[model samples]
Target: MKAIVCTGYGPPEVLQMQDVEKPRPADNEVLVKVHATTVSMGDHRIRSFTVPSAVWLPARMALGLTRPRRNILGIELAGEVEAVGGQVQRFKKGDRVFAATLQGFGAYAQYRCISEDGPVAAKPRNLTYEEAAAVPIGARTALHYLRKANVQSGQDVLIYGASGSVGTYAVQMAKHFGANVTAVCSTANVELTQSLGADAVIDYTADDFTTRPDRYDVVFDTVGKASFGDCMKVLKSGGSYLNCTPVLPSIQVMRAKLSGAHKLILGEAPPETAEALDFIRELLEAGKIRVVVDRKYRFDEIVEAHRYVDQGRKKGNVVISIV
Candidate 1:
């Protein structure tokens, strides 16, 4: 199996392509022949060790003190099941599936084995492998925070950075959750966000989005460029402020929920974070959601994809086809 192995954590260049032994399914696992996967912001963050010092310390304990515990760096994948363990009941050898690989993180390889109980789901019939591969990570994150926000139909929800992988899904899912969506992004992504069912668009380059007179019932800051305090000013009295970034202040906001204003919300999506994957899969299968692929890269070009995503201007997801 050809896999992208991270020799050490520093730059995208550290991800070296090598032929590694293919994994076999365990008694309760399924072996998947990966057709497509994604090079997400999470992948970059892990590969480069770009997390906050507080978060990094814990992550280092989990990943490794010196190098990563897991060598291959990928999570989201869409592919066909090549074989299933004897105990597997929900899937068979030919079942098409899409899933997030949690800590098992080996989707950068040509094959991966995942437990049937993992975030695995039947791939939506309407989507291509590339499209399905892009869903799990970003969609799960969006779903996690929106549920935290408890979005209501008539209430206004503002999605800052409503153009990134998670932001695009956040916009659409919030609309699906019945909120009137307002997307804040650059002029280039205005149409893309609006097309995803955003009721209004704010060009951040031309306007201070916080100054808008219409306060929102929920404000989701997907980019983390805005502070919780800054976002709260644009929220209605009881509105919640949600951020995707894993910054220290966001962690404090999460802790503050124990004593202080639950109004400021911080979303910490857990690994294997499949709690929201089922909902996202249903929405996709029902045609209520769509995957937004800003670009597609081959396995060999993954480092380039990382570079593009690191530029901080991607309109949507960046896919990497594994097959």
Candidate 2:
């Protein structure tokens, strides 16, 4: 099997294409021949090891000390089951599936193994491999934070970075949660955000959302571009703020406990639980959520794909076609 091997924690150039042994399934695992996979902010963070010190330290202890523990770099994949262990019952050799690998991040290769009880799900009938590959991470992140926000029917919710991968899904999910959605993005993305069901679009280049008078029930800073204090200014009494990028100032952590008007919630990708995967699959089947892909790269050019995602301006997901 061919895979993009991450040489070490550094720039995108560190990713190299090489021939590696194909992975086989264990007694309780299913071996999938990957057709598509993704490159996202998390992949870049791991590649360059740019995560915050607090997260970096703990993650280093778990992943490795000086370099990465695993050489393959993808976390999500959509593929066909080529073989199944004798104990596997939910799927057969020909079933198509999409799944997230919580820590076994080997989807960059042509074949990878997923446990029968993992986040793996039957691929939505309407989506292609590339499209399905983009959903697991972005949709799971959006779903986790929006549920934390607990948006109400008539309340207003603001999403920062409303045009990025998670932001795009956040806008749609907020609308699905019945909140009147206001998306914050640059001038170039106004129309795109509106098309994704944002009730209003705030062009950050022209207006400051935090300085506005109208207060929101929830302010979701998908990019972590603003601090908790900056976002708190526009929150209504009892409103909550969510940050997808994980960083919390000590004062804000303390303040959240004391004030009803302000609160902070940090996000993580939902655990690869059965219920969470089922919920995402249900939303996809109902047509309430969709994948937003910005670019597709051939498996051999995965190094270039990493560079594109590292640019930090991808409109949505970056996919690598493995098959």
Candidate 3:
């Protein structure tokens, strides 16, 4: 099997194609022929060892002292089950599936063995492999934070960086839950965000978004580029501010939650579960939500894909065809 091997933590150039052994399923696991996968912002940061100065030591220890703990970089995948272990009951041979591999982080290969009980589910019947591969991490993150904030219908919601992978999903999912959404992105993505059902779109490049008069019930920062204080200033009393790109438990967030009128929420990715995927799958098949593919790369072009995502301007997901 062919895989993109991360030589060490540095640049996208460190990712190189190489022949590797194919994975085999163990008891309670299924072997999948990987069809597509994605290079998320998480992938880029891990590969480059980009961590805040405060968490650098801990991040290095968790990822690896000298190089990535895992040589393969992809976190989610869409694939077909080629084989299943004898004990596997939830999946069988030929089942089309999509999954998050955040636990082991080895979806860059042509084949991956996943535990059937993990965040694995049948792919949405209406989606292509590339589209399904884009869902798990980005969509799941957006959904988790929204639910955490207890976003209510008829409440005003603001999402910053509403053009990146998670931002795109956040906009649509918030609308699905009946929140009045305001998407903030660069001028180039105003049309894109509007098409995702954001009730209003703010062109951050054209003006300061915090200066808007309408206060929000919830403000989400998907790209971690928004100023924390600025986001708080735009929220209504008792409103919530959620930051997706969290590295450590923030002291400021803790203090604000205790002393301020608003809530500052920071969370890691929720546990990937088949239940969540199944729910999202139904919405996808129903055409209630759609995926935006900014670019598609072949398996051999993994390095180039990372480079593109590092540019930090993708409208939505960037996928790599692996089969």
Candidate 4:
């Protein structure tokens, strides 16, 4: 098997391709031959060690003392099951699947082994390998946060940074939940956001969303580009504010909690589960949601893919074809 190993963490250049032994399934695991995967923000953050200052020490300790604890650096993949252990009854040797590796982070390879009951599920019948690969991380993140905020049907919802990976999914998910979705992105992404079912699109480059008189029942900052105070001003009383990025605790969070008028939601992402993956698959199959792949790169061109994502210009997901 071939894998891209992170030779310590610094830049995209640190990712080196080399021949490695193919992983085999354990007694209760399934061995997948990876066909496609993604270069996610989480992967970039880990590769460059670009984390919040408040978590610098803990990040370093969890990732590695001086380098990455894990060499391969991908969090999700879509692949075909090549072999399955005797205990793996849900999947067979030829089943196609998509899954989030989560903290396991070893998808930048040709083969991976996951437990039978892990965060893996059959790929949606309507999606290709590349498209399915893009779903686990972005969809799961958006779904988890939106559910946590208790998004209700017919309520107003605003998504900041609505052009990025999680933001793109959040827009569609918010709509699926019956919220009147307002997407805030740069000028170039206005149409793209609208096409994803946003009731209104705000060009953040030309205008500030908080300045408008309109208020939202829920404000989700997918990129953490907006301050809690700014978002709070536009949130309806008793509404919720969700922050997806990692940042130090803010006075606004404390104030919100104390005032009890608006709730501040920020914390670690929910763990990926098989049920979540299956839910996403159902949505995909039903045409309620779809993946927006910004670009595709060959497995050997992972460095180039990373460079593109690092530019912060990709509209949606950046996929790496592994097979």
Candidate 5:
């Protein structure tokens, strides 16, 4: 099987294509022949080893000192099940599935062995492998944080970076949760955000969202570009602030927590689960949520794909087609 291996933590150039041993399933796993996968922020962060200097040592220790603990750097995939373990009854050899590998990180390969009970589920009938591959991580992250905040009907929700993967999902998910959604992004993404159901769109380049008089019940910084103080200023009392790319907690974040004036919800996304995948699958199947794919690349073009994602300009998901 062919796979893209991360030689070390540095730049996109470190990712190399090589022939590797194909993976087989365990008694509780399913072997999938990957048809598509994504170059996500997870791949970017791990390959580039970007983090705050404060947590640099700890992050290094957790990932790798000189290389990634998991060298193949893909977190999500969609494919056909080529084989299933003896104990697996929910899936068969021909079932179309999408899965989140997360920290296990082997989706860059032609084959992956995923736990039958993990974040793997039937692909939505309406989506292709390329579209389904982009769902697991982004959708789950958006759903988790929105639920954590217990976003309610009639509340105003603002999403920064609303054109990116997690941001796009957060925009749609907030709407599905009945909140009035406000999307913030570059001028290029205003229409895209509106198409996803954001009630209002703010172009960060043209104006700062913080200067607006209206306050929001929930403010989600999907790409970590929005300032904490600026977001805090616009957050209504008792609202929640969600950060998809969280850094060290600041004094204001702590103060808000101590005073019970606001809540800061940030960090790694919740571990993927079969239940979560099933829920997202239902939404996808029902057309309650939509997959936003910014671009697609051939499997052999993985390096080019990585370079594009590295630019931080991807509107939604960038998919790598494999077979």
Candidate 6:
């Protein structure tokens, strides 16, 4: 098997292609031959050690004191089951599957072994391997946060960073829940956001969304670029503020929640589950949601893919074809 080994946490150049032993399934695991995977912002941050200052020490300890504990850096993949252990009843050889490796991070390789009951599910019949690979991280994160906020139908919902990976999925998912969606992005992505079922699109470059008179029932900051205070000003009195990337000020919002005025949600997403993947698959099969792929790179070009994602301008998911 071939894998991109992350020698250490630093520049994208640290990722190197090398021949490695193929992984085998354990008694309760399934061996998958990867077909496609994604270069998530999480992957970039972990590879370069670009994390929030508050978690710097903890991140280092969890990832590795000197180098990555896991050599491969990918977090999600779509692949075909090549073999299954005797105890695996949910999957079998030849089953097409897509899954989120989460903290495991070994999808950059040609083969990986995962528990049959883990965050693995049959790929949607309508999607390609590349498309399915893009769903787990962004879509799952978006779904988790939206559900946490308990977003209601016919309510105003604002999605900041609407052109990025999680933002793209948030816009569509908000609409699916029947919320009147407003997407905030630069001028270049106005049309793209609107096409994803956003009821309105704000060109952040030309206008300050917070200055508008309109208020939202839910304001989601996917990239953590907006100030919590500014976002709160645009929220209705009882509206919820959801920040995917929380900073120090987010703590104030959490404490203020004790007053019972507004809801504040900021934290790591829940573990990815097969149920969530199945829901996404149903939406995909029904043509209710679609994968937005901004670019595709060959597995050998993973370093270049990381470089592009580091710029923080990709419209949706960036996929790496593994097979």
User: What is the lDDT of every predicted structure here?
Assistant: 0.85, 0.86, 0.90, 0.91, 0.91, 0.91
Query: CA lDDT of 68 in candidate 1?
Result: 83
Task: Give Cα distance to truth, residue 79, candidate 5, Å.
Answer: 0.5
For 5-70, candidate 4 gives per-residue lDDT tens digits of 999878799999999989878889999999999999889889999987888999898989777988
Write the residue-wise lDDT of candidate 5 on 49-78 in tens digits.
988999999999999899998899899999
**What is the lDDT for 120 in model 1?**
87
Ranking by lDDT: 5, 4, 6, 3, 2, 1
Give the Cα error of residue 296 in candidate 5, in Å: 0.5
- The residue-by-residue lDDT of candidate 1 on 1-323, one tens digit each, is 89999888887888899989988899899999999999887788788888777777898998877778898989889999999998999899999989988566888999999988878888888899999999988888888888877887898999999999889999999988898999999999989998999999999999888677888888898978876666767777667878877657546466556545546655576446344666777888899989999999998999898888778798789999988
Query: TM-score of model 6 relative to the true fold?
Result: 0.97
Structural RMSD, model 3? 1.3
Error of 1 at 220 (Å): 0.9
- Count backbone clashes in candidate 6: 0
Per-residue lDDT of candidate 2, residues 252-273 (tens digit): 6676666655666775667776
> Model 2 misses residue 309 by how many Å?
1.2
Deviation of model 1 at 218, angstroms: 0.8
By TM-score rank, best first, the candidates go 5, 4, 3, 6, 2, 1
Question: What is the number of residue pairs that collide in model 3?
Answer: 0
Report each candidate's C-alpha RMSD, comma-separated, in the order given. 2.2, 1.7, 1.3, 1.1, 1.1, 1.3
Q: What are the runs in model 5 whose C-alpha is more than 4 Å off?
A: none
User: lDDT tens string, model 3, 1-323?
Assistant: 89999999998999998999887789999999999999998899999988899989988889999999898988999999999999999998999999999888999999999999899999999999999999998888898899889988898999999999889999999999999999999989999999999999989888898787889999999988887778878889999989988735557566777887887777567776787888889989999999999999999888899999888888799999997
